[model samples]
Structure formats: C-alpha cells, structure tokens
Target: MSAFPKRDFRASMTWLHSWAGIIPTLLFFAVFWMGTLSVFDKEIDRWMQPESRYAGPPIAYDLDASIETFIGAQNGVEVTSLFIMPPKPREPYLYFYGVLAEEVNGKTYSYGRFVGESNEMLGEPQSLAGSGFIFPFHFKLHIPGNFGYYLIGAVALAMLVLTVTGVIAHRKIIADFFTFRPTRKARRVTLDLHNLMGVVGLPFYFLFALSGLYIFAGWFAALPMQTVDGVMGKSPVAFLELADSQSPKRRPRAGQSIAMDKAIMPFKTQAEALWSERYGAPVMADRVRIEHYGDANATVIVHRVFPGRRVTMAQDRIDFDYATGTVLYDQQATPATATRSWLEGLHFVQFEHWPLRWLFFAGGAAGCILTATGALFWMRSREKKAGAQPFNIRFVHAMTVGSVTGIMLATGVFFVANRFIALGALPPGIAPIEWEPITFYIAWLLSFIHAAARGRSAWMDQCFFIAILSLSAAVLNWVTTGDHLIKTMTTGMWSIAGMDLLLLLTSALSAWSAIHLRGKARQRPFAVQGDDPALQPAE
Candidate 1:
C-alpha cells in the first residue's frame, strides 16, 4: 500500500521534504529576502527621506512644546489618541501620529507628521517608500485584508514541517555541512550549496519560522481561544478583557473641564522624573501614547529608549492618569508575557545591536540562497528526463527565474524611482509614495514576461539589468542630493553614505554573477537532457 517501506522513515521524510518544500519555497524566498532588508529599515528610511536627515548628533527636544504645536495645528480635528516617537541614532527626527475620532469611509486612519529637534514641523513628503514598503511586504506580500496574514501563516507552518523533514532526510547533515564541491556538475553544485546553507543555518531557519507562527498565533489558530471560551462558558470579548486587563483600556472622551496643555505637561515631567529615578539615567521617551485624550479615563503611556540591552524594544514603560498626572501602572511584564516578548523581539531584532542584526541579515540571506538553489537543483534534475519537458517543469522553471531574479530587478527599479521622485522628475500627479510600488510591480511584471520569452537566458539578462540599475541608483542619489560618498564620509552622514556604499557593492556582486552566469551558459547550452558528457555527474 505504501510507495516506500514503513520502516524507512528517511525515505518517507525525503519525499515529504522534496514535494512539501517545492511550491512554498518560492514564497519563502520572497519573505526571507524582504525580511533581511528590513533589518536596516530605519537607515533606509533616512536614505529615501532626505528632509528627515540630520547630520549632527542626537539632540534632546521639548516634548511638551512639540505636542502643543501638534495639537494646535490639528485645526479642531477630534483626535482620539496621539503618539510621539522621539529621534534615535538612525532615525534622527521626532514623529507625531494622531488617530482621528472619525473614520474615513468606515475605515479608521492615522495621520503622521515629522518634527525637528526645535519642535517645528518638517514638511517631509508623506510617502510609504523605503523601509515602509519592504517591512509590510515581507509579512503581508502587499495583499489586502487578513487573507495575507493567513496565507503567510500557512507558509510558515509548511516551512516548519519542511525544516523537520529536511533534518530527518539528511542523515549525514554534519558531513554535508562540510561537503560542497564547486568543480562538480551544475546540478551537484546547486544541490551542494543548498545542503550547505540549509545545514549551517538550520537553527536560525527553525527559530524564525517558529517565532513567526507564534507571533501570529491568533490568526493562524483561533481554536485554542475558542476552546478556552467554550470551557469557561464565556464570550470572546469577556475572555479578551480578562486576558488583557493589564493593558490600557480605551474609553470615549468625557469632555471634562481640563486644558489639553495642562493635562499633558505634568505627565511629561513626572514620567521623566520617575524614569530617571528608576533607571539611574535621564529617560528619553522613545514613544508617548495618549489614549482617550480630554477624557476623564484618559491614560498616558511612556515607552523609554534603551538600545542593544535586550532583544525586546521598549521593554520599560510607565503609565499615568492623564488628568492628575498620577502613576497608574508601573509594573513590568509577567514572566509568560516576557517570554513571548523575547521571542517576538528575536524575530524583529528591535534591539540596537548592530553586529547581531547583521548576523541575522546574513542568515536570512543564506536561507534565501538555500531555497533558490533547491528550486534550481530540482529543475536541473528533471532536465535529464527522457521525454520533452513537462508543462509543470517549464512552469516551475519560469516561476523560479522570474520571482527570484525579478524581485532583485524590481528592487533596483524601486531605488531609482525613489531618486526620481525625490528630484521631482516624475509627473506632479504621480505621488512618490504611490509610484514607488507602481514602478516595482511594472518592472516585476515585465521581468516575468521576459523570463517566459527567454527561458534560461532570463537569469543572466536580469542579473545584468540588476547590476546596471543598482549602480544607477547610487549615482542618482549623489547627483540629486549632492551627498556623494566622500562628502558624506567627511561630514559624518553615515546613514546616506552607508546606503550608497551598499548599493555600489550590490552592483559589483550582481555584475560578477552576471559574468559567471554568461560563462556557464556558453559552456553548457540549455537542454532538457543530461546525457551530454559535459552534464555528467562528477565521480
């Protein structure tokens, strides 16, 4: 009844790993690549938004003054909540966001404005470019609604299964870790690379997949909560209230007799004093969230900044009664919540440890390489089949080349378009924030078309295109902003300079890859069979 013997766990797992991974691996690659880029998201934000750039050191600003100005500028708009994000090392500008009381067409929306150290508004163009694009795209795939969340969650579950089965299938995983033969045939080389990256980065891959699932556990599986509710004979709302009793509660505004400025200033002063007394240092508020503004039940939550100390960002917080400026809650997270926070932090790398963040990025890239090569290896293995290439095989090959290299090319186009928008080269109607994604999708669609038309040559052509576009982005930045690499280095503008340097480095690597692919293409022409002596496996 079974294709393999029941006793052969390895064979069964090998089959499971191969087929289970084939389809989802493409999605996994996109997620890994985008997630890797998101590590330096704040820095990229600075690169794209020149108006928010600050060349000098971090400065302390008056939070009260900024808040007062922001409120005054609201022009009688009823704001339900306000958030103030202070400047940090990479993000050197204060940001103000307000949630409006009224919804736009039944959907609630928040408005944001950038503030300088002097508490003056910096009218930076409101665009969801740079890190904003890549960050959400990583988890959501830019898909609308909760469907993207569920879809990515399913993929994460599949990845978890693939990791477990992969471990079982590779019995000699340790040996394979040290066994890559570059001189072997193309298929062997691809397989070896796949094995090497997978084996070496297995722990990272497993943790990321597991943590991602846990982070979205609610969306992935509601049965656990449902069971709890059923057992207790309680509604979901009541259960949620019990679970989140420690969190701040939201309430409607009471329209009490309290001046907005008077209500906010005392809380700011007390929060700073309390934080300094507790941490033995002056507290720079990373974030200040005020809910139910002007209401008797209003609450203010102050989140402090402490970088590189732990995995979790904003672990410390102080809550206050908005009207009286009295401390309401000053408790740390419970052990259970702390553990969950740590896992979430590990996945996000919100802590400011540069070296560890780089390690995460490298590991994520390794995971992408592992997926890409696995697909390539599968395609190569089937190329030796006797009959004509099957439709499924061709389809997989087209998708492999298109999605893999297409993403890179599209990313290049995104950078170039960012520069064009910033320089006002685009049409006035085409907003920078909106056009960035538009350009990316158009380029990506064209890449798929090219892949379908050119077959194997698509790889080389896309790589070459990526090289040119990458270099162009760096050049464009310098020409438009007059912030050349040498000037940025001399002036200590590391954020912009670092991004430019990385772009150049990316261009070089892409060019090298293109040349290497060209040589390989010439040496072994595209074929559906490995019967040729050149395609023979190395002994």
Candidate 2:
C-alpha cells in the first residue's frame, strides 16, 4: 500500500497533475468535444444533407448490376474492384466504389451514389457531412501524414498521466464525487466543479484515454510483427492479411481478361446460398469487395454484419474465389484480436444502443467541463504569481475561450451554413458543397481573433453567439426542409427529431450561461472565472 513517503509522493503528484492537465488542455478538449459530436455523426449527416433524409420504403442492391454498370461505361478505366454500401437508416442511398486497374490508374478509387436499385451513378458527394468532417476531425484533427495520429496519441498519454497523478494528488475523491458548490464564490465553485467532474468522470476519463492510446499506438504494439516481417523480407501487408482473414487478398491479374458478367458470376446466387447456411439464416450483404478486376483469378468478399446488434464493430465477412464460388476464408477474430476490437469499439461508439450512446455523450461533455475548469482553477489559485506573468495568464485564458466556446461556435455556424447555403449560390470556381467547410474554418478562425481581442469579456459574448447560432440553425432547418420538430416527431424520424431537440437544448444552456455571466458581471465586473481583486479569497 505504501511504496514511497506518502506526503512527498502526493506533493510531487499534485505538481505533476496541475501542469499535465493544463499543457494539453486545448487538444484534449478538441478530441473529446469532436468525439462527443461524432456519436451522432450519421444522424448529423442526415441533418446536413437533405437527400440523405429521404424516407422511402427499404430497397435492395444487386452486385451484378453494379458491377455491370462500372465496367460498361467508365471509358478508359478498367475496374479492378468494387465496394457497395447499401441504403440504411439516415443513409438511404447506395454508395458504390470502383478501384481502377493498377496499370489503368495506379490503384486509384472513384465512388458515386446510387439512389435506388438501378445501377445509375450519382456524381461526387453533396457535402462532407458530419461523418466525413466531424468524425475524421475527432481522430485526426484534420492534420495529414499521420502526424495527427501521433499528436493525438501524445495527448492521450498526457491524459493518462493526469488521471493517475490526480488520483494521488488529492485524497478526497469520494467526497468530491458528491460535492459541487453553485452558490459559492466563482473561484470556489469552479474548483468544486473541477474536483467533482474529475471524481465522477474518473473511470470514463481513464478508459477513453487508455483505449484511444491503444488504438493510435497499436502499431507500436505490433513491433514484434513488424520485426518478423523485416526478418522475413516480406511486405508488411502480409501480416495484415494474416491478422484479418476477410481483408481482400490480392492475386496478380493474369492477362486473361473476362467480361464483367463472368467476373461477378459467383456472387449472385451461389455466394448467397453459402452465407445463408453459414449463418444458419438468410444473410443480407452489407457490402462487397473485389480484387483483380475482370481477371479470371479475381477474389470477391462480402461483409454481412452491421454494428447495430452488437457492442463490437461487426466485421463478419466471407471471401470467395471469383469464378468457382468456392469459399476462400471467413473472418474469425482470435481472442486477442477480439479483445482489441472491443477496446476500439468502446472508444468509437459505433454500436446502436441509445442509452449507452447518451451516457458516452455525457461522459465526453463532462470531460470537456473538467479540462476547462481545471485550467481556470489553476489560474485562480496562482493569482499572486499571475501579476508577475500577465501575458501567460491572458494567453491561457485566450486558449480556453478559443478551444471551448470557439469550437462550439464554429460547429453551430457550420450547421447554420448548411441550411442557408443549400440553394447553390457560391461565387465562380467554388462549388456549393465546398463552401460549407470554407465557412466553418473562417468562422472558427474569427472566433480565436475575437477571443484574443475581447480578453476576459469574450466568453460571455461567444456564449451568446453560440446560443444564437444553435437556435438559428434549428429554425432554418425547419424553414428549408419543412421538417420541424413536430413533423419529424410524428413521422417517426427520431434521429432528426432528437438532433433538433438537442439543438434547442444547446441554445437554452448557452443563453442561460451568458445571462448568468452578465448578471455576475453587473454585480462584480469580471467575476466568474475572471481576475478581480475585490473577489479574492481571504487567506
């Protein structure tokens, strides 16, 4: 129980906790904040894309038809492979992809949307939408070249350090779990919330951080496999193929090209009969993949499971030899890999459990609050030294304002812009859908500038702006789509209705916080989480 002198250990831990908590606070907030929003990413996709909100009878897709369409009219491009995502809730369109022959385009992929059972292709994506923009930003921060992976990995590591040191730094976590002081002075109230969020969210914080680290640094754990590959002088992809049996296995294209109908012959009936027996029931193919397009030896794979019925990221799939319909491999995760998949699934929240999804949202929001308050509390606690370091205090406050309220403001604007810009009125050269992200970044950059210029007053101002944007976006959705809350609620479109309800709640909360801050400012200007000498605690 006792490894080192308790007092000294606690002292060191407290010191570490304070700095570690603040150093990566901005990136940490961004990750959790975006990740929380990503919980409803597909729902948000429906909100952002009107075509995606189509409410029609369920439709089926034909792989042979899709393959025929791809190979027939792509002009000089020889299709090597295909991926098809069938219509699903909030995503009621068939998405089809074609991988070009290696010599044809050096292994490039092109994709389009198909509205119904017909094999006709709809042109490029209408918008980035939530799944494309918000979800990727959660893990990548929009950074390229795997740098984002490493950066996020580092932040997760810091969170683990902060979590451990916080446990050791303070001994009254149980008390703090039940403690929050709303009526006290701003500093005391902030500190109580900081402790309370830390206590109540300890498990959530630890598990998410741990899982996120493992996901990004999983390659680090594969060092042994990498070493084995290096020793064997094998392409690293072979290790991946061994690890994931359902992943596409490549066979060199034998110059003997075949017709599209012949290449897709094995998938239409024989494959379905096989999978139906394998699962002990009829199976609906979720997506299909192929390799060595139009070649006699091409491999075809079908993924059948969706993420709704299980907590794990469903990867149930079977591979087939193209011409013969003979089963090549069926995915079966080993115990170790299954555990890893669960850890990843837990962090990603891809499952369809509503209660757990909301809890994850709550935990992520709590983390945001914890990091924000912890930073503010540290600043207030060091008020004496703050005079000697005005620039640093101001810098920290600016970062907090920009990272917290600023990002929320930007997202609200993004949603609002999606409705306002639907009429396709962008100036020459810029596409209509392209303006969505352009507006988002412009709004975000301006938020940081506003925070820097307004100093301590920016928080309340931006809170009011967030409220305005949220309310505006919700109302505009009604104005444009005629899918008001009542209509969606009655029509059984709970996903859209739920998102609308959340928008209203966001507006209400932001407005209340702004009004509260204004009232406190009238009582003592710059009162809550601000530097005011008259409000300082008597030591």
Candidate 3:
C-alpha cells in the first residue's frame, strides 16, 4: 500500500534521495576523504615531522626525567595543569601541552615538543599534518567557531536521510547488492556502482553519521547554555560542571606554591600498580595529567587503555592528590557511560588494531565512491535536458568535478607543500605551520575556478593534475626526507612507507582514470556519452 496514495511514494522517495544527496555531495566527499586520511593521523605526523623519526633506542619510561625536561624547556612561560604524553609504539614524540597562565596572541594553550627519547627541544613542528589539520577538518571543515559544528551536524543528519530515502527508492535493494555492470553504458555503469557500494557499505555510513552526531552532542547541547552563560557572566566551562557530576570537579588554587625540588612524578608508578591489580592485567601508563600544578590543591591523573584487549576506550585511570600519595578517584565506567564509550570507540577507533583501521579506511573510501558515483549518475541522467537548461546542468557539472577530484588534488598539494615550502622563504608574517593549510585552501579554490572555466573537460584535466600531484608528492617526500620505499621498508618504519605506497597507488588510479577519460573524449569528440538513459535496473 502507498503511504500517500495521491502521490507515488516510491517516486517521491527517488526524487527526495536524488536532490538530498545531490545538494551536499561535494561536502560529503570532503568529509569522507578527510576522515579516511585521519585513520593513520599519527603515522602521517611521523612522516611529516622527520625529526620525530628517531633512530635511537626508545626512552626508558622515566617520569622524573620528563618532569625535569618539561620544567626547564618552558623558559619561564607559566603553564598550568600540564598534560604529558610519553613515547608509544605509534606516537614517538614526547609532548608537553598545557594551558598558558596568560593568553598570548589570542591562544590559551601552548605546546612544547621534543624528540621522543632525547630531551632536545625541536621547537615548532614542521607542519600540523595529521592530528592538527586533517583529523579536525573531518568534523569541522576548518570553519570558524560553533558554525562548523552546526554545519557538520546538519550534513550528518542529511546523510541519515539520504540513506533511508535511497533504500526506500530502490525497487530491489537485495539484488542491487549483487549487481554491477561494468560493460554497460556510462550512465548505467555509474548507477550500478553507486547501488553496489551503497548497499555494501550502508551500515558503515549509517553508524558513522550517527556516532559523529553522538560524539558532538555535548557541544550541540551547550549552545543554549552558552548564551545564558554569556548573559550571566560565567566562564564557558560552567555548563560542564552542572552537566558532568560523574567526575571530580576542578579545584580552585589554594595560592600556596610548592618548592621546585618537590618531585611527585612517582605517583604514575603507584597509579599503574593499583590499576593493574584491579584490572587483572599488566597495564602500562599512556599519559599523566597534573591538575592545579604548583599549587597546594594539585592533583595527578594517570591514564591508560587496553588497546588490543578491548574495543571500549574506557580511559581506565587513577586520580591522586599530588601533594600526598592518596588515591582520590579510581574510575570505573558506569553502564550508561560505557554504552556511550563503545559508540564513540567505534567511531574514533582510538585503540590500536591494524585490521580494524584498514576496515575503517575501506569504509570511508566506499562512502567517497558511492557519493561520487551517485552524483555522476545524476549528471548522466540529466545530459539530454542540458540543451534546455544549460546553466543548471553546467553549474552542477562544475561542482561535481571540483568537489570529487578537486579535493583529491588539493590534498596532494598539501602533502607536497609540507616537503617543498622553505621555512625562511615564507612571507615575513606567515608561520611555517600556518602556511601549509593556506596552500591547501588556495589549491582547492583554484580547482573550482578551473572546473568552471574548463566545463566538462575539467574532469580530464583535473585527473591529470591529480596524477601529477600524487607522483610529485611521492618524489618530494623522497627528495626532501631521503626516506624512499627501500630505505623505510628496510628500517621497519612501515608508517612512512605506507604513506608513500598510498600516494603511488593514488597516482596509478588517477593516471588510469585520466587515460580512460581522454580516450572517451577522442571517440565522441563532442558528447563523450552515447545516450542519456533514465535511472534503470542493471540486470
């Protein structure tokens, strides 16, 4: 029975799915590409920050040495509630991050980096390649303020809508899963690929969208309260205190300072001991957070996660009164909180699992394929009508080219810029780390302009650019860093090697696509497409 008998509900669903997916297809592709890159964010960081790829032995977990190093390296810039990250298998850099006692250049937090083992300060990082750039771009799109969150939230919501409407519009969802016609016409072939990917990767699409929404719920929930807090003249975090009653609250400083000689770093060892005994495993420490540092009310929280053992990143920790050896809070996740953690863990994949990481990479790639193919199918279906509505079809075609291949081209530029941009040659005002993303955004904008100018030929031109950029980035990585495939492979630095391999693979694929598109253009010399078929069954 039709849900609305007056209107063909399935036809309405088909229309809804087409327009809804079409509207944000480019944005969806951007998010999918960034999210995929973020899967190995740390590995990319290692590759970009060549200084971090230390050849020396791993640092013996000396909490005291880390403390001494942190203090002397600060150079009198007051920092509070310090968070110290030690060397791990994936992340080799010893990172000292904390809130500045007083804001500088409109920034509240300051970060200090050092080689993972040696205490020599490396100063500012070469670039914010991974954790600082690509990872954040996935959720935020680098849009300023809460607007990015709101916009991404709306896009995620649209994804859920598109997924449902697509399923409802499909007359035979089951058969579509097993059907993809490579030998068919371009219009039919893209539709088949779109259906095949959408069916196969549906769960990943749904869950990623849902989980991303959940992960940002608190920020969304904070909007109304932020307005109220603004009116009431309270600190922004005042909402968190009211909402988060589960964890211990931040204490006010008692104003009494401790001597520099006082060493409370041993608490990490004690906390690990208590946690290992409670959890029935030998758990090592990941990082330690010293809250209210140098004050009488100081406290220390040591954190760890059982990466290979559990998928739930529960953040098993023991909080201590830093002045004394007293366990203040030994945390155990509540049932409700554990449920939330499992959902978040599924989305973030913070734990170390190679196979699961690759699975997520595949899922993200599948999203990109489905979205791109769906958009292409729409363009193909509209070709016969192009003569009547030239502007609309042409406009969307330009968008399709820019958003699909343009983002890929821009990312290649980002990688290449990291290697080639000389620190000293940069304009007087621009910092090295800040310059790379600037190059990325500029490259991306130029892509849209090129697409608008070149029309349908833009697709072939951009693919060629994509291939050359990918190949250039790989060559630059070797030329600048001297870490080619053979060097990195023999040295057991698989992460760097993996990045090179991915770039080469992208080059191969884009070159093939460029060649294929070029051949099609030659055969037609005009239309490049034989027919304008309506969306139809493959088999």
Candidate 4:
C-alpha cells in the first residue's frame, strides 16, 4: 500500500514539501548552524578574550572592590547595574560587565556589556563584548527585529509542514529504516539519506520547530487578540506589570551612598542558609547590586547562579533595604518558574555537568551534519530530475553548496578575521558594520560566484578551501593569543584551546570529504534509458 493513501494526497504533499523546502532551504541552513552555535556563545566570547585565560575564578571576588576598580578606571562613569558571569565549562575567569555613559562626537552614547578586570577595562574595545555573530544570526541575518522574527516564524512553520509531508512520501519507511546505500550515485543516495535522517529525527525536528514557534508564538498565532488588547489601552500596563513581577523593584532615593557590601550581607546570609537547608548544597555568589544611588530608600539586590534541583541553574535575586540593611524580599520562585528555569538551563547548557554539556555539544554537531547533508541531497536530486534544464539545475546546485559549505568557511574566516583584524593586518576601512551583516554577506556572495563558475567541481573545491582555512584560523589564533591547543589543554584553559582542537578535527573531516568527492567526480558518468526495463532494478 502507498503511504500517501490517495492520489491527491501524494500529489498535494509532494507539492507542499518541494515548494516549502525550496523557498527557504538556504536561509534554513544558516539559521540551523547559527542557532546551534548560540549554545556555546559564551565560550566563543571567552575564546576571543585573550586575557580571560589568565583571569581567576568568575565568582571568587568582592563585588564592591570589583565595581570600585571598574568605575575608578573610567573617569566620570556611572554604573547602572552589573551582570556577573559565573565560571564557565573549563574557564576560571570571572567577568564583570556593565554599561557606561559617554559623549562621543558630541552625541550622548551608552556603551553596554563591557568586560573588565577588578576595575580595569581593556585598552581596545571589542565588538559587542564577544557576543560574536551567533546571537543576532539566530533570528535575523542581522535584519531588523520586526521583519526578522516574522520571517523566521514563517520558515519554521514551513519546516513543520515539510516534515509532515515528507513522512507521507516515503513509502518504504520501515523496510529502508536503517538503510543508507552510499554506494549508489546522486539521487538514490541523496533521497535515501534525506528520508532516513529526516524521518528518524522527525520527533526532534518537530519539537524544536514547535518550541521555536512558541518563543515567538504571540506574534503570529495571537495577532488579533494582541491587537484588540492593544487598542483597549491595557496591554502596555499589563506588559509592564508582567515585567515588574519578574524583575527586582528599583530602590528609592536613599540620599547617600550607603555601603552596598553591608546591605547585601543580610540577603547573602539568608540565601546561603536557605540553600543549605532546602537543597543540601553550596551556593556560588556572582554579583550584588545597589540601586538608586544617593536615595533614602535604595535597595540592594544579590544575584547568585547555583546548582539545585528546582532551578538547576538559578538566579536568586535577594533584595534588601539599603539604609536599614533589612531584607525586603526573598523572591523564591515557584514550581512553574522552575520549569521555565529548566528550559532556559537546557537551552544554554548553563547548569550542566561536563558529561551532559558534551552530550549537548554532540547533539548540536549532529544537527549541523544533518543540515549539510540535506543541502547536498537537494543538489544531487536536482541533477537527476533536471536534464535539459541545465541552467536552473546549476543555479539551485550552486546555491545549495554555496550556502551550506559557505557558512562553515565563513565561520572559520570570522575567527581568523577576529585575530588579524585586531592587529591592523587587514585593509583599512574594514571596520565592522553597526549590525555586522556585511562580513557574512561578502563571504557568502563570493562562495556563490565561485560555485556558479565551477559547476560540479564546486563541492570538492569548497570543502578543500574550508579545511585549509579552518586549520589556518586555528594556527592564527595560537600565534596571537598564546592560548593554543597545547598550552590551553595543559593549563586547564579548555574553552579557548578546546575550540581550536575541535576546529582542527573539523578540518581533518573536511579534508577527507574533499578527497572523497574529488575522486568520485572522476568516475565515468551514466545515463539510464527510461524505456529499458533491463536497466531498471527488479520491482
């Protein structure tokens, strides 16, 4: 029996899958890769920060002294609040980040998310304090927020639809369940792997699609209700109230700079006691904030990131009155908040032990492989279906290769550019754009041009380029940062050096694939006669 159940079912579903995947395949590849990278976003930040390798534990510091040093280093700087990062996977550096108000070119400016030593800022400013390209690349290709979210949501919904129709089209679902006939050429090979991987990972794909949509669900699904509520004039206040419910309230004017360290002591004591009794654990304190400086009723808030069952990675905000040093609010979260907390923890891998984080990392790599294979499958299928339509076939083929491999190549180059650009080795006038889309665009555009020119040879050529460039970037990082693989591993500086070793491993894989593709392309071509029953496999 056909999996499609009816003639129209097969026709309609085939139509849906083909068209849905065609329009967004390129964009989808980028989204999948970038979003995966956001998992280790902070590690990328640590890798880019050369000094972090030598910095101490992220939490073992006095907040008052750290803030004092940071503020004193920048003359006339006012501190709004500070975000303290806990010790990462293998990095010991405690990072203190804050915003600074400054006047640049006669215009008032606010600089955000700056990293510093106890109080000393770095000599040269780095782009967005090591956020790299992952965060913005996830939703937008650095596009405007409004347009980007809607576009991404649409793509995700299309993917959901594609997954459903795809399952319906694969008739030999269980018979070919574990079969991957890589020996077959082009379409058969591509189709087999595509269907196999897509069907096997179908559940995960659907979960990710659904979760991603829920992250932006309000935009598309609840539009009319949102509009109606907005028109009623209660939405703004409701939104603010929701935000306030989560955020710590601002302290009133205390009329003096009361000792923040003293104010936080009470909350810290209470929190430590609570954690020891309820969770039977030790807590790591990150930072404490004193809001509304010089105000009479100013409050102090202490934030800690600790390991616990309820909120495996929890941020407990303990508020205290600045003048009285009295505990104002304990702010313990509910069971539902813990569920949200766990989702966040799982998303970032923030509270994971080493084994779990590595497991998550492996899963992320699988996703990347899945994306690259899907693109390759598209190319091979088009070659079989498109005989006389050579130009259209080549166009899609080039795009598939260009976008998939191009992203990998560009990521390597971006890391290389980070080191070289800092030393003024690149050309002048290459300052990063406000949103930094141009760099990725230029790299991707060059890949398109190269792929279009090279035709069938593009895949092997790009793979070889990626292998060389990736290794080259790793070498360059070692030269500049002195945080190469050997030293980093030996010194327990895993984040920076570990990333380098991973790149080297990736390079090796790319090199092997390139060699394989190059050899395969040299084989003789075959064109099957449609009318020859003998040429067709036994049905």
Residues 159-275 of candidate 2: C-alpha lDDT, one tens digit per residue: 899888888776666666687779877787887888888888899999998988877667556545444334221321333333443334545667787664664535635656766
Candidate 4 ranges beyond 4 A from true positions: 1-11, 55-59, 86-91, 97-119, 123-130, 218-270, 285-287, 304-315, 432-438, 524-539
Cα lDDT tens digits for candidate 1, 1-539: 55544656777787777777777766887888888888878777877877777788666667677777777776676776777776777677777766666654432334445545665665435445555788878887877545666778888898889889888877578667699899776777787888889888989988999888887884335435444433221221233323333355434457774556564556666777876687687665566778677667778877663444578544567788877777777755556676777778898777778789889989988988988987887677666662474676677877888778888899899888888877788877876668889999999889888988888888999999999999999999889888999999999988788889989988999899999999988988875333444333211
lDDT assessment of candidate 4: 0.61
For each candidate in turn, the TM-score is 0.88, 0.86, 0.91, 0.82
Worst 10 residues of 2 by lDDT: 231-240
**lDDT scores in order:** 0.74, 0.74, 0.77, 0.61
| Clashing residue pairs in candidate 1 (N, C-alpha, C atoms within 3 angstroms) | none
Model 1, position 100, has a per-residue lDDT of 61
User: Tens-digit lDDT track for model 3 on 1-539?
Assistant: 65433547887888778888889988899999899999889888887777777544555545566677766766676766677777777776677766568776655555666675566666657688887789978987877556666778988999999889989987778766699889877778888899889998999999999989988895456556455333221322233333432354556678898754556567877877877787788777787778777778887878775344567766677778777768887777667777767778888877778899899999999999999999988876776446678788788988988899999999988888888553245666877878889989999999999999998789899999999998988888888778899989988888888889998999999999999999988876653356533454221
Best model per lDDT: 3
Worst 10 residues of 3 by lDDT: 231-240
lDDT of 4 by residue, 491-532 (tens): 766677667887798899999989998887777333322332
**Candidate 4 colliding pairs:** 58-94, 69-119, 70-119, 253-295, 253-296, 254-295, 254-296, 255-294, 255-295, 255-296
